[model samples]
Target chain A: MAKEPEQEFVTMTPQQKKARRSRSLALALALAAFVIVMYFVTFVKMDPSILNRAM
Target chain B: MAFVDKSALGDADFRLSEATAADFVALLKPRVMSLVVFTAFVGLAVAPAGMNPFLALVSIVAIAVGAGASGALNMWYDADIDAVMTRTASRPVPAGRVTPREALAFGLVLSGLSVMTLGLVANWLAAAMLAFTIFFYAVVYTMWLKRSTPQNIVIGGAAGAFPPMIGWTAVTGSIGLESVVLFLIIFLWTPPHFWALALFKSGDYERAGVPMMPNVAGDASTRRQIFVYSLLLAASGVLPWALGHASAFYGVGAALLGIGFVHYAWRVLAQDPADAGMKPAKALFGYSLLYLFAIFTFVLVDHLAMRMIG
Candidate 1:
C-alpha cells in the first residue's frame, strides 16, 4: 500500500496563542526583574571597605 | 509558518484549561502565607537590631515566597489525599486547576528564587533558615510524617514556627532568646490548634487516610492532648513578657489571650465525644487563629511603640 501525506495541524486557536504569548512574556519579564533585584541587593550588601579598596 | 507534528498538535488540542493567575495564587496557600508573613514581619520588627526598610521588605517577601513554595510542593505531593479530603479537595493541584508537574516546577523555581534572593539581601543564616523551613515542610512533613504518623502536625509545626526566627536572623544575623520564644509560642500552640480541627474533621482525615491525632488515639485522648498543649502554649505565650523582651502591656494582653485559649481548650476537653455540634472544638479552632494573630499584632505594636518612644 502507498503511504498517505500527513495533514497540517493547528495546535492552538488565535486567542489561546495570544494568551500563551502574554504568559511567556510576563514570565520572562518577571525573571528579568528578579535577576536585576538580586544584583542590586548584592551590590548593596558589598563591603564598603572593599569598594574603597577597589577605588 | 512553523511545522508542527500531528501527534504534538493532538496533544495540545486535548490540553486541559490553562491555569490562571488565581490558580497559581491558590497553589501558594495564601492564607498560610499571610500568617507566615505576619509572623516573620513581627520577628523582623521586634529584633533588637534594626534593618534597612527596603532590605527588610525584601527579606519578608522572600520568606513569604519560600513559604508559598513549600505550600505548592505540599499540594503537589498531597494531591492524592487532598482529592479525597473535603477540606483540601478544592486546592489547585487536587481540583485539576493545576497539574502536579506544573506545581512541582513552580515550587522548585520559587524556592530557589526566594532562597537566593534572601541570601543576597540578608545574611546567609536567614536564607539557610528559609531553605530549611521549605524542605522541612515539603519533604519531612508532607512526604514523610503526614502519612506515617498521627503526630504529623506536632513535628510539622516547626516549619511554620521558623519564619520569625528567620526574620530575626535577617536582622541580627543570629538566633536569640527572643526568636526562640517566638518559635516556642507557635510550636506549642500547633497541637492544640490543629487537634481542635481534627476533633471536628476526624471523618475527613479518616476518609483521606491521614493519621490525625483524633483518628489514631480516639477523640478523648486527642482532646486531652489539646488541653495539655494549650497549657504549654499559654505558658510560652507569656514568656516573652516575663523575659523582658516585651512590655508589660504585651505581657498582660498575651496572658489574657493565653487564658482565653486555655479556657477554650478546657471546653473542648469537657465536651462529650458523641456531641454532634462539636461546638467547643469548633470554637477553639476559630479562637486559636485569632489568638495567634492577636499575639503577633501585640508584638508588632509594642515594638513600634518602643521604637517611637525611645
Candidate 2:
C-alpha cells in the first residue's frame, strides 16, 4: 500500500475567520448590486420595439 | 487531523488581514465623495437637456464612485505623508487598518468599474472625463504636484472641479460654457479654501514635508494670495448670470455668497500674525465649505425655479 501523504493546513484565528467571512459577504452584496444596476441600465438602453421584432 | 503548517509558509505571508468594511469605506473618503456627488448633481440638473431620472442617478453614482476611487489612490500614494499628519494619520493605509497594496487594488478596481459603468450607461465623453479626473487626482496631483510644489492645491483642484463638467457632458454629450463656468468656480475657490486650512495646519504640512502654500511661502504671502483668489472666486460665482445662463435670482445669491467669502478671506488677510489661535484662518476654512455648498445650491434651485416658471 502506498504511504498516505500528509495534508497541510494553516489555522486561522477567530478574528481572521470573522474578517474573511465579512469580506466575503460584502463582495457578494456588491456583485448583486452591480447585477441589478446592469439589468436596469440594459432595460433603459434598449429600444422600446426591441421585443416587437418578428420571430 | 491535517498537520499544521507553521513552517510551510512564513509568518508574514500567512498572516490574515483584520481590516473591516469600515476601513475600506474610510479609504474612499466619504465626506469628499459627498461634496463631489452634490456638485455633480447640480451640474446635471442645470444642463439644457434633460436625462432619464434613472440614467441621471446612474451617472451621479458612477461619478461619486470615481471620485471615491481617486481618494483611495491618493491615500495609497500619500500614505507616508499621511502617517505623519494629524489630520490624515488615522486614514486606513497610514493607520494600518488596510495595507497600501490592498488600498491600491481597491482603488484601481473601483476606477475601472466606475469608468466602464459610466461608458455603458451614459455617453463615452462623460466616462472619459471621469477617467481623466481620476488620473489627474491620483497620478498628476497626488503623486507629482502635491509633493513637489506649493501650488499643489491650485492644480489638484482641477480634479475636483471636473465632476460637474462630467455631469454636464453626460446630459449634453458635450462640454458647454455653463459647465466650464461651474468648473471655474470650484477651481478659483480651491486656493483660498486650502490656504486657509494650511495657515492653521502649517505644522502638519511641515512635519509631513508637503509644500503647502503657508509652509513654502510666508504666512503673509499665503494670506494675500488667499484674498486675491477669493476676489476671483467671487466674480466667477456670479458668472452664470453675467453670461446669461442663470437668472438674476441666482446672480443675487451668488453675489451675496461671494461677498461673504471675500469677507472671510479679508479677515484672514488682516489677522495679526502673533495670534496663535489663527481664528481668522479657521473661520475662513469653515465658511469656504458653506460658500461652495450655498453657491451650488443656489444654482440648482435657480435652475428648477426657472424650469417651473418658463
Candidate 3:
C-alpha cells in the first residue's frame, strides 16, 4: 500500500495568543505616539508665532 | 496571524519554548535603556537653546531605541560569555528564549530604524553620534575589547557617555563645552563603578575568560585604580558648577556627593583583599549608582529653575 503525506499545524495557546495581542497593541501605541510627536513638531517648526501666542 | 511556516511545523524536533513578549523586552536590557533615556533627557533639557517639545520627545525616543539596539547586539555577540557568567546566564539570548540569529536580526533592524528616524527628525550630527555609539558598544566593546583587554570598560564606557552629547547635538546641531563636561563625568565615573563590581566578581570574570580589571591587574592594582578614577570622577562631577554652567546650589550638592563617592572608594581601596565580606566594594558599587542619578537630577533641577526664573 502507498503512504500518504500528512499535514501538520502549529497553534498558539490561549495565553500566548493574548500575549501576542498585547504586544501588538503596545507596538501600535508606540507608532501612533511617534506620529503624533512628529506632527506636533512640524506644526511648531512651521509657526514660530505659536510659542508667542502660548506665552 | 501566526508567522510559523508549515514546513517548520512538520518537523518532529520543532518545539516552541514559550518565549514571551517579556523575553523580547529582556533582550533590550530595559534597566540600562532607562538610564540611557534619563541621561539623554537631562542632556536635552539642559541645553541652552530651546527645542520644540515634540522634537525633543522624538530625539529621546530615538536615542532610547538606539541604546536598546546596542544592548541587543551586545547580548547576541556576548552570548557565550554571558552563558558562563552567573549574573548574565539568564539573559534572553543565553537562556534559549531568544535565538542568536533572531537577536542579531532584531538588533540590526532596530539600529537602522533608530539612526534613520533620528536623522530625519533631528540633525545629522545626532544621528551620526547614535550610529557611532551603537557600533562602539556592539563591535568595539563587545567584539574586540571585552575579551582582549582589562581596559575594556574604560574605553567602552565612551559608548555609554555619548547619549548626552547626542541629545545636545539634536538641539544645538553642534557639541559644546557643556555637553563635553557631561560626557567627561560619565566617562571618568565608569572605571570606579565597574572596577568595584569586578573586585567582587573576579571569579565570574575568570570563569568567563573576560579580562576585567581585577582578573588581569590583580586586586591591589584594581583597588588603587578605582581610587584614582574616583578622585578624577569627583573633580569632573563638580566641573559644571566650577565652570559656571550650574549654580552655587548645584556646586554644593555636587561637592557633597563627590565627597561621599570618594569616601566609599577610599573604603574599597583600604579594605583587606582576603576579607570575606567584600563590604566596601559592594558599598562603593551601590553608592556609584546613587551618585550618578543624584548628580544628573541636580543638573535637571538647576536647568528647570533657571528656565523658570529667566
Best TM-score goes to which candidate?
2
Better of 1 and 3 by TM-score: 1
Each candidate's interface RMSD (Å, one decimal) is 4.8, 5.0, 4.3
Clashing pairs in 3: none
lDDT of each: 0.90, 0.92, 0.89
Ranking by TM-score: 2, 1, 3
Which stretches of candidate 1 lie above 4 Å from their native place? Answer: A1-9, A13-22, A25-29, A32-36, A39-43, A46-55, B1-17
Local lDDT at A48 for model 3? 65
| DockQ for each numbered candidate | 0.25, 0.40, 0.21
Count of backbone clashes, every candidate in sequence: 0, 0, 0
TM-score of each: 0.90, 0.95, 0.89
- Model 3: lDDT of residue B169: 91
Q: Say which docking band candidate 3 falls in.
A: incorrect
Compose the digit string of candidate 3's lDDT tens values, residues B31-109: 9999999999999988878887877888898999999999999999999999999999999888987778778988999
Off by over 4 Å in 2: A1-8, B1-14
